[model samples]
Target chain A: MKREKVVVEKIVETFGLTKRYGRQTVVDRLDLTVSQGEIFGFLGPNGAGKTTTLLMLLGLTEPTSGYAQVLGLDPRRWPLEVKSSVGYLAENMGVYGDLTAYQSLAFIGDLNHINGLSQAIYEALDLVGLSEVAHKKTGQFSRGMRQRLGLAEVLIKNPKLVFLDEPTLGLDPDGIATMLELIERLPAEKGLTVVLSSHLLHLVSRVAHRVAILDRGRLMAVGPLEELAAHAGVSADLEQVYRYFFKNHSQVLSEATR
Target chain B: MKAIIRKELADHFGSTRFMLLMSLVFMISFLGVFLAGQGIREVLAGGGGYLLRDRTFLLLFTAPGAFMPLTAIMALFGPLVGLILGFDAINRERNQGTLSKILAQPVYRDEVILGKYLAGLITIGVLLTALFLILTGLGMTGVGLVPTIGELARLAIFWLMSVVYLGFWLGLAILASIAFRSVATSALAAAVVWILLGFFVPVLGQTAAAALTPLEDPARPRAEELAAYDHVSRLFSLASPPALFGEAAVIMLDPTHRGSEQALRLSTMSRLDRLLLNRFQGVLSVAQSLILAIPDLLVLIAFSLATFLGSYLVFVKQEVRSA
Candidate 1:
């Protein structure tokens, strides 16, 4: 009997990925995969190696062991290729303080080598609801406006994959809502695959189709929200499920110590 | 890469820093022209008798002094501008959380470095050229004198020398910026290095040499003392920028005053003898000057290349993060 070939749909894959700073390991051995056209959220608290993992995926920082591949290209070896297919926005992303919103967008659009750059910039600005402030210097922009501008940069390239490390990090409630809506629409509207890492588990659950929870440089759990909730013996609420995992792990450590 | 370079140039020109530097250059150029005019008038009118006597050495040395303030700015800020261009080249993007965004683009890392470097080089080149034009205009107008073909050649050499000098400082700044993550820290490091190279190194070298070889009293064994003094003087001269620059200026300005005793003695002979001696001295001085310039140019280029390569490697290895 002949066996059928198994096909993998994942656009990003990491195997035993680790990063260390001197004696302390920031991101321990980890395995992860993000399927094509999916919104994958990475959830963790502060100092849980969320940013380090993202950097390694982007090939901005080298991993201590193992490797990551995006679009079937090794991140460390073919970063430019991986990068070209992906758009990314890290926490607290800054724009050139001196440039106006329009100027900054045009400049970034040019760098991305996009066709009809000026039109793309205008469209990005409009998508972010920043058209009114397009002429204002970025230094004068509010935190939400700057975040929107950063999102515009990610959107201008029309990349297949996007890495957003805290897309709404410093935004207000309304700004957060706007950002979440944008994040939710990307996959369906643009055929984009997104990997978003954030400490806000509830926000991640609301916007993402699948979520990976990391704690202390290790993956605590990863799956669809409902699946993780079911496994953790919680109801439909992902927030409660995430809390249960952390509480359960802490209780086990405490019990062992006693 | 061209986009990045264009953006950088736009940012640099839009900055207040460039405006302030331009203002400083203009002020210095005007002052230099005024001084040169006053001196030239005195010499041409022959009103101040014996003013030119024993003053050729002083004149050659003092010409550099007129431009010292401008040269000092080049030595000090060339590195500063380079550091500013590079320090945040990657880190700011990371801090703004845009590094991943940029890296995700099609541009290569080497392209980013090259683009930024080219932007910086262009800015420095434009500034230097503007200053040179200003000086040239003033030299011609204020003194009412056009440089001879030889003088024009010497000025071209001086302009080339300035680029090498500025490159040394700019390269150091780039290295400092790459080595330090914080812009403030990088700027401080570059400033410290500039201080050492510009102000302290020559002074320290001279002090060390003087301490090693002491001068004897003029009263005892004049000839022997002279011999020992000459030997020590050669070593001391090596420590002096004024000495090196003076030798260069003489060959450039006169081209007929090579340091040979026979040539000097011939100048005091008949007019025909003096003319022949001047021609011989010009040829000899040109050769000697070229020999001296080789070491200076080599040191400048070597230091610049070392600094530039060090900065490039450090930047390549740097960890990107949003902080």
Candidate 2:
């Protein structure tokens, strides 16, 4: 007897989404889907339009053309609704420098209209393992501490979909392991669907069920880690598969130009 | 929203910025009062001489001028506070990658903007009110001078006018914050705009009006010339809050005195002698107060709305990630 495949419940869908700044196209025409209860990793190199793409999906930035829907609502027209259902952690993940860890969490909880905000704040602090220093001002916090606080802020609301952009960028090895554990636990523990972007293929492969590789403003490749590795004719190492794909594509483009 | 406002007030009061602002306010107000008191004391000690009499009137007129230096200081820093408070209102969250986190909950963008603006306004309102109370307290304690009902009425109008004045700068700051990506750039942009609107534009307006309608003979008895001067002066003065505030304060302080020879001549005539003194019997009605107040209110509202709407539009169009 075969276990049933979880039906893909689309949480986010985009059709021909494009974004341009001045004369430069940042996110070219692209179609994408994020299913409910999946940790989807958006893998990209520097300036690969990962952040820009996520911003358009989050309705924080408008697309030049095409449509985006988050939780079945057009992002442009119903941004507030889309935002309400989605949790986003950007690249920098700045906490209110002046606010204490506890105070920052409380403020964000209040903004989100979260009930039992004090308790929620404490719980979030504990989850991030910053409970001991929750009262310390974020300005005094280390980069890893700020990153944890940023994650705590997102978790405070218990969002349905979480967007984490380089969430563990500045964390130490221990912090990274803690964050990875937290991310892995989220989908099962809270029924959350996460869409995180990172250049770290190993990290992405460990947690994400499905992955989309972005190069420049275009989609380079996408699939499950194992399938993508097999397709690249490499060992079951996501990093090696990613490098191989990119290397071959660039080599092909160079040869074609010659 | 209320929670946001409470948090903002807490943050403002907790920050060193509020302490600096309070100190500045106290310093300016104390200086104004001390100067006024010294000038008055000197005139009284001079024993009713002609110069003393003229100086008493000048001292009263000059009370409004004290607000000028204070207004300049406020204009310089007001936008700085607005930019600092609001520039990162959305972008910092994006940069910190918390924008999505906050938005994922049940909050609206309008609520965020409204909450932030409300917090800023509340902080400013509390600061201004505290300053007003301090001034009133000092006046009562130091000089044994309790403002009369009429004077109190004028002070209220002056306080009300300040909201508009501050609102203009606040709106500009918000616009700058939305337009720029960095807080430093926003602060600089707002300061430049402040200097232009608060100082340069008003001076330009005065110069243009002066060139258009040069000052006529001060000794002239021509009513039309005097009316043109008054109209032009009032119109030019409307370009700056300090000028508008000064005019409003003057009207409130001495509603019957319109800087006319008639008011001066009437000052010399006794109440019973007024019947005999037909030359000094030009009655200054309450109608003049209404006329003066109406324009001041309209101009303040118009400028406040322009700045507010401009800021709102910019905020609405702003990309969260840009900041």
Q: What residue pairs clash in candidate 1, if any at all? A: A83-B104, A93-B96, A93-B97, A94-B96
Can you write out model 2's per-residue Cα lDDT over B1-323, one digit (the tens) per residue? 66557776787779786787667666765676556655555655776364331123323323433343333434444444444555555445555545555444455555555666777776667777887777667656654445555555555655655655666566566666556666678778777766776667677766675676665665653555555544565566677654555455455445554543344444555777777776543423335554655666677668767766776677667665633
On DockQ, the leading prediction is 1
Off by over 4 Å in 1: A1-8, A250-258, B47-104, B217-279, B283-292
**Candidate 2 Cα misplacement greater than 4 A, ranges:** A1-6, A248-258, B41-113, B215-226, B229-233, B257-291
* Local distance difference test, candidate 1: 0.69
For A162-182, candidate 1 gives per-residue lDDT tens digits of 899888887899999989998
TM-score of 1: 0.84
Local accuracy of candidate 1 as per-residue lDDT tens digits, B1-323: 99889987897788787788667656765565456555666676885454433233223213443444333334444444444444555444555555555555677766776676677777767876777777766666765556555455555565566565555565666676557766678778877775665557656655654565555653553444344444454454444333333344444334444433233345347788777755754333434555546564565667667777787788777776646
Give the per-residue lDDT digits (tens) of candidate 2, residues A86-190.
777777766677889999888877767788988999998888899999889899998888888888888888788989999888788887888888899889988
- Clash number by candidate, in order: 4, 7
- Model 2: which docking level applies? acceptable
Q: Lowest-lDDT window of 10 residues in candidate 1 chain A?
A: A249-258
